[model samples]
Target: MASREFLKILSSARLGDVSAQQKLADAYLTGAYKTPIQPANALIWLEKSYFSITNQALEGASSGSTQISELIAQTANIPLAETFGSPAFGFGWNSFWGLAQSSIESDSRSAAQWQLVNLLINPINQDIQKQLSEWIKKNATSLEKVSDLDLGALQKLAKQFLNELSESNSSFATNAKELLIKLQPKNEALSSLWKVWQEDQNEEALTQAAELGLTAAKLILGLRLAQLDGNTETKSNASLKKAAYWLELAAKDGDRDAWYALGEIYRRPQFSGYNAAESDRCFDRAADLGHAQAQLRKGASLWRKREKTEEKIRGLQASYWVWQAHQQGIAEAKELLNKILDSCPDPKKNDWYELAQFAEQALNHHAEHKLDEDWLLLSHRIIIANQFNFSKAELLLCEVGQLQHEHCVAVDIRWELPKILPRLIQIESIQQRRALLAAGKVFAAADLEIEGNLRQRRYRFDQVTSWLVTTFFKDQTESAIN
Candidate 1:
């Protein structure tokens, strides 16, 4: 059931309040803004809200818990967390219940089972876990849903939970390994070899399998050799040489994972002669071949190497690979992309930089020509200017207006309260209320002086406002369309 507080926020958000919309989006993302975990809704609000601070550098770090701290740091001009309330607090639910319910309704037993296992690792009460254990026994026979949870978080949680069980002497300990294999399955033959090798503490079967051309098996064996070689590179160690031989064989057989593994081996100078160039090539090959992890590695690698050379678009190139990985549903990639995009400038989109500058000026209450109902009809000019062609700015602006006020929203009929009034009157604090209104003014204060037919330079009003609206979608006339 939705909480009363969530309901109130939603009501305000529906009425077109900018702060409400942003808060609502934040809530969905982190439950911090005092909202439940509903990423779909969060994305909607994020796409809809136009921020006064659009600089990527201004975004709070992706750490869910530190959002408030980060927000406080970003808005230093305002006495925050005090007379003016900081964004409402709470970490919304990012739990197993949603997936568990989906598992119950779906038909994919594999997926359901995975969800149940994931749920098992959450910080649930022991009683709940016992009940869940029974529930899994009931539903384990069948699975029918594949959750869209962030892969990185899921993997981390899985590893942590499984590691606990592996180290414990509890009743759950016996089946922990089985559960991991079930939660994230691999090639059947390779898995079987690993199962015995890991469980029995015997490597004979796994080694045989690697020799028999099982690529996954070979990768595992190579990893074992690398671990055994420890911090010293032994050119004479037959084990290390043998590991390399098998890794090369796997790579030759078109195993992308193998190439990445080889890169990892070469990356560690502690082991032996770590050739940075060779390691880079191996990683690059793996990235080109579409290994998502490898793509992230290369992205970070290139960015780190930027200081010593005049590398053109080093960050951009890195971001492109990271973005590709993010699209493939890698959560770590999303986190990295967020940081990269926030700080990296888009040379192709200088307009974005201009917009950020305008946002900064507006927030400082320094923007000019922000009022409406003018003779020049600046709002209309912004739409017709075509200077921001296909910039996708309009959609965001429309959302910004609605976000400021629950009512009086739209491109033509925006809730244009005075430079002193908030879009949402529900704001109670005088300073807080004023802060909201001021932010709105900042958004409306876009007056771009561009070269014109009548004059060398002309002020374009509502450039920021119209930019809040984006027509990136087909056949629609609402801010929500884009």
Candidate 2:
């Protein structure tokens, strides 16, 4: 019969049925349950039943089998496939005893067997070493067998068990460390594991390990202590000093994160009085160590400092660093780069085009860091530069103050004020008049008559004469002097 039917036998055994319990144990040991059934799970279930049977036998009561099915299932760790039908049931009392013999070693076997069982079952128990020592003394033969089993798997199992125990019991961690040291004397893994245990926020573990020169433990313990001394007004300097000591050691060990933390400390207004120069150096060092976020921060510091400097080259240098950071994919670096490039002038037309193309490629490459504001401003500049009247007006405004209304004629107003003025005047089509006004040359009476007609509301004959005397008088005076 398949082993599943053995569950029923186990149930019957639990009700003080000795025959059923023996039959179930026989089914598991002889592989009569099914083909390809695992012996490990079979042994576990049989062993539990054997213990119950032994307990009953000792008590002189009906050896009712213990319902250890739940414990068996919990330890199985693997899945079982369904059996199609029950196999032929063979009745044999001798077969049950033989199956039981293979799994349950005699008290005479070897010491290794006892140690193996103890290690597997009670690996995390606090008294494991003592219990193992006792088992070795009582069952030397069992221990011999245990030494023959796989050592690697046993060590892994022990570590796993100890890890679980360490979660709730600090003493277990100490014991586990001792065992690991005995097993792998020169290995660093044990030390590293202990370090993790110490850093765990458990107060007991942290204090104990921090005293043992565990750097990470020391750092975390210091931070926790600082947090407890909350009233910074009373203990501010002391707290910073403590934090700084651990942080300096960690930073000296090439911990880039430690450098960044130190930078934050020095940069804090309350702690370091905002020492920008010192903070910048720290951030720069961290950035050099391939700290991506630190690169961004360093670039920002330079950009801010550049804003307060009078040197134009300083502004460009700031933009250079920001671009360097942007190349490293910092989002804020692109914003800073845009602001710098917006106000800076290009020395050549080709350079200006290249700058525009660079902005376009930046938008293409890093869509998240697109220089939208700078692009829009440059685009507007290009559009205004293309218009003749607006360009002339801009140049003229740079040279002269705001144009007076009456000085519209004879003043050589090369300044194209069309962009500044409302659309009421159409200066684009009057190319000749615009040229004449720009050259500081007087136009013929007929041309003036046309202008008077075109802008009659603002330029009447009397007003036109007054504009000539006031606005063009400078030119007249210059001509007389020449």
User: Residue 52 in model 2: shift from native, Å?
Assistant: 88
* Model 1 CA lDDT for position 63: 42
Candidate 1 stretches with Cα past 4 Å from truth are: 1-201, 228-238, 270-273, 290-293, 307-314, 324-339, 343-482
Residues 146-171 of candidate 2 have per-residue lDDT tens digits of 33234455545545544443333332
lDDT for 319 in candidate 1 is: 65
Per-model TM values vs. the true structure: 0.33, 0.28
The list of candidate 2 runs beyond 4 A from truth reads: 1-195, 203-238, 268-277, 307-312, 324-329, 341-482
TM-score, predicted candidate 1 vs. hidden true structure: 0.33
